[model samples]
Target: MTNPEYWYNTRTGEVEKGRQSAWTDVMGPYPTQEAARNALKTAAQRNENFDAAEEAWEDEWDDS
Candidate 1:
């Protein structure tokens, strides 16, 4: 059988074994409890990385 995925409940800052909260208040299908627990941190880092990449891409096309 497949293992159950973990989810981070944003509303209560808890790590759940599976989907147990409203979709709007949860953050994942993370592979482990630790990952789910760090969901906000992970998301912030990813957002920063994506923003940096987007800025670089735009800079590459600027002629001025």
Candidate 2:
């Protein structure tokens, strides 16, 4: 199968195809343009949830 054709340029918040910039400045191999466009928001949401979960876990440990 071929690789995904869409990417999210984290540095510029642009949805594009192939490599438009350095690998470190982008985040995707998203299969659809819309998914690439929402990459940063999605990442932020996931990070927030993860941090919340980590905080809860730490609180549980602290109460032990």
Candidate 3:
């Protein structure tokens, strides 16, 4: 099993990802990508999408 990871958006404070037909960002930090996908949960929906654009980015930078 894969250790599920959650990403938070820094721009709109909404986590965004690709859904079936379009993108969505309703409830973030979803347990699984499939959950996020179903609700269309994505950072872009809140108009805060970007390349690795998330509060977690800082952590990634720190690790590097």
Q: Candidate 1: lDDT of 12?
A: 95
Candidate that beats the other on lDDT, 2 or 3, i.e. the better one: 2
Query: Clashes per prediction?
Result: 0, 0, 11
Model 1 C-alpha RMSD to native? 1.2
Q: Write the per-residue lDDT of candidate 3 for residues 1-64, one digit (tens) a residue.
A: 7556443444344444422222242355567655555434444555455444675797789899
**lDDT by residue for model 2 (28-64), tens:** 8888899899998889999999999999999999999
lDDT of each: 0.95, 0.88, 0.48
Query: How accurate locally is residue 59 in candidate 1, as Cα lDDT from 0 to 100?
Result: 93
Q: How accurate is candidate 1 locally (lDDT)?
A: 0.95
Worst 10 residues of 2 by lDDT: 1-10
Instruction: Give the root-mean-square deviation of each candidate in angstroms.
Output: 1.2, 1.6, 11.6
Clashing pairs in 2: none
Q: Rank the candidates by lDDT, best first.
A: 1, 2, 3
Off by over 4 Å in 2: 1-3
Give the better candidate number (1 or 3) by lDDT: 1
Better of 2 and 3 by TM-score: 2
